[model samples]
Target: MEKYTHLGVYGVLVRDDHILLIQKARGPHKGKWDLPGGSIEFGEEPELTLQREFIEETGLAPITGNIRTAVSYTIIYQYDVNQMEELHHIGIIYDVELLDDQAVLRTDGDGQDSLGAKWIPLETLGLLPLTPFVEMIMEPAVQEESDVGMGTEVEG
Candidate 1:
């Protein structure tokens, strides 16, 4: 039987002139840098989902800012083990800022499962091999140009 799953409760965390990224530990994108987030349980709000995800993946309490963008994507996954094919996912990507300035980077496990969380510079982001949509997400915040819908998450 083909399985269709819903993935949510995810966000792109930005902090102190840098963005926080997690190295995937499993699945198709394992070993690649990705925004820290995952599936939202039933009846859970997106913001809550992301906050919970941060603690689970990075061991920090991150605060979300704005809803930068929302897009629905149809992903085709064909599991080689069982030759099963499936499709489905409405990815809700958001912009967020980390409150903990003195936070340290930490890896979850295996240096792949949820391994390594760090704030990398925008310049370096383009150079590194990151997960899908990650590089694009930073484009708005890093650019100097005005009119980039940078909604305020909080006050300093």
Candidate 2:
């Protein structure tokens, strides 16, 4: 088994009972709905990483936000025929506010991990495939419904 860790900056942008989310194009959370943000580059500040990733993933530029909390998760999965990896992912979450909530978002893939960004109704979150990080951010009821079990829970 291989062990690795990832530290990323994420943003939670909620507006009028809806939350902004991006579709993961790769990784353990591929094909799931996840918050906007990603790995911080070397020499890049967390806040700057948040801003850069937010734009890269969502395409709604000219925004501001602040750190809300820090969250972590651990998952072990197989990436190849006989390869197993234990990934410890740490997220620095931010409370982001868009200047133009009504502005159009980039729905196409960002040519990277994001398939696109969309505003998902809070009430409908449970009905969709969500990353563990998103589930941790959701209400208690939704959290309970998530696949958080022994040695398999996604959040810490």
List, in order, the clash count of every candidate structure. Answer: 4, 0
Q: For candidate 2, write residues 7-107 as lDDT tens digits.
A: 99999988776789999998888899999999999999998898899889888876788888899999998867899899999999898978876667888
- lDDT, candidate 2, at 125: 96
Q: Write candidate 1's Cα lDDT for 1-156 as tens digits.
A: 476766764677765557778888776566778887788888998888888778778877747656777654454555677676554655678777767767655665434358767777865776887766575566665554223335534333
All candidates' lDDT scores? 0.68, 0.86
Residue pairs with clashing backbones, model 1? 24-112, 25-112, 25-113, 107-116
The model with the greatest TM-score is: 2
lDDT of 2 at 70: 92
lDDT of 2 at 86: 93
Estimate the TM-score for candidate 1.
0.73
* Full-model lDDT, candidate 1: 0.68
User: Whose lDDT is greatest here?
Assistant: 2
Model 1 residue runs over 4 Å out of place are: 1-3, 110-113, 139-156
